[model samples]
Target: MDLGTSLINVALLAMLFVVAVAIIRMRSLFAIVMLAGAYSLLSATWFVVLDAVDVAFTEAAVGAGISTALMLGAMLLTSRTAKSERAILGVVPFLVCVLTGAVLIYATIDLPALGDAASAANSHVGAQYLERVQADTGVPNVVTAVLASYRGFDTLGETCVIFAAGVAVVLLLGFGERSLSARSDKGRSRKESK
Candidate 1:
């Protein structure tokens, strides 16, 4: 990658880290959901820097857009603020997360460098796909050809999954006579009255 693109990627990663920290610390459901969306957008930007525009588009649309909307809808059924928890109770989960992160980082050590021409992927299937895509699919753009022709069923499956998720979220949040939030509020009021 060029220096400028690398710098942009680093900046986006930093932003994503900051957003993640904010999401972890915040008690407000709305704020946390917004930060999660922002984190997804930063991730999409980094993917773009890596020349994975298709993945970036998917991240932006699904992660930032649809997922955020669904989460906000789900959040409406719960209290706006999270219940406070004892700090000691968080220690085990925090340590588990740290260990998982360390393991994941260590696992990347043996992976080939990005864009390495000698890498197994770049030297084999990727090259073969590039060579045959145009003739097989009659598509000039390899990415389009791969998605629309080579992996058509996979793409359709993904689209169906996203659509199903949206429908499920809508049904969960909006199908009842009263919103889940309203029912919860009414129950709280009845308890208070008693």
Candidate 2:
């Protein structure tokens, strides 16, 4: 990538990191939810920078839009502030996370360098796909052709999964609100009778 792209990526990543830290340190559930949405939006921006428009769209819709709305709905049925509790730093979980990250980084060491023309993926299926996509699907955009024609079922499945998650969130929040209101109504009836 060019210097400008690299700089943009660095700035985005830095902002993402800052937002993540703020989310972790935040005590208010509302603020945390907002920050999480911001994090998702930043992630979508980074995906766009990498030229993954479809993935960016999915992230923005699912992460920033639907997830934030669901969280805000759930928050309506719960406390806005987190309960105060003793902070206990767990060493084992931290170590496990570090070890997992280290293993993932180590695994990537065997992967080919970015945009390496000689990489197996670049030399084989990718090259064939690019060469044949126009002929096979009559789509001018390779990414569109691959996603729409080659991986249509996968895309549809992903869409269904996102839809189901949104429905589930709405149902849960609705049920929670109904239960809370029912209890409040019962309490009011009891108080009036007394």
Candidate 3:
């Protein structure tokens, strides 16, 4: 990658790391949720810089937008601040996280350098798709052609999964007007009895 692109990537990654640390350290539910959304936004920006606009849009919409809204609604049903807890329980998780990160970094050592033309990802199948996508699919944009034509079923499955998950989240978050009205009626009955 060019120096400018590398610098932008580094800056976005640094911002993401800072937001993650803030989320982990904060005790207020509102602050943590906001920070998590910000982290997702930064991740989306990073994806854009890496030339993955579609993934970036998905991350921004689902990760930052829908998720933040859901969490904010859920947050309203509970206390604003989390209860203070001892850090003793966190040590094991922290150690596990560090070890996992180390292993992941080691695994990447074998991967090809970024944007290497000869890398397996850029050769053979990818080249073929680029060359033949227009002829086969009659789509001007290769990315759109790949997603809509070649991987149509996979895309549809993903859409269905996302829709189901959104429905499940709404149900779990107690957005049912019937339940709210029932709880209020019970409270009114108790008040009237007194």
Best by TM-score: 3
Each prediction's TM-score versus the true structure: 0.78, 0.76, 0.81
Against the true structure, whose lDDT is highest? 2
lDDT tens digits by residue: candidate 1, 1-194 = 68987788788888888898898888899999999999998999889888899899989998999999989987987889998766576788999999999999999998999989899989988898999987798888799988888899999999899799779966876566576789999999999999
Model 2's alpha-carbon lDDT is 0.91
Q: Order candidates by lDDT, high to low.
A: 2, 3, 1
Which ranges of candidate 3 are over 4 A from the true structure?
Answer: 89-95, 166-175, 179-194
Please report, in order, the local distance difference test score of every candidate based on alpha carbons: 0.88, 0.91, 0.90
Candidate 1 colliding pairs: none
Candidate 1: regions farther than 4 A off: 89-95, 163-194
Q: Which ten residues in a row have the lowest lDDT in candidate 1?
A: 170-179
Clashing pairs in 2: none
lDDT tens per residue, model 2, 89-113: 7999999999999999999999997
Candidate 3 weakest lDDT stretch, 10 residues:
169-178
Higher-scoring candidate on TM-score, 1 or 3? 3
| Candidate 1, RMSD to the unseen true structure | 6.2
RMSD of every candidate to native, in Å, equals 6.2, 5.0, 4.0
Q: CA lDDT of 4 in candidate 1? A: 83
lDDT of 3: 0.90
Error of 1 at 138 (Å): 2.0
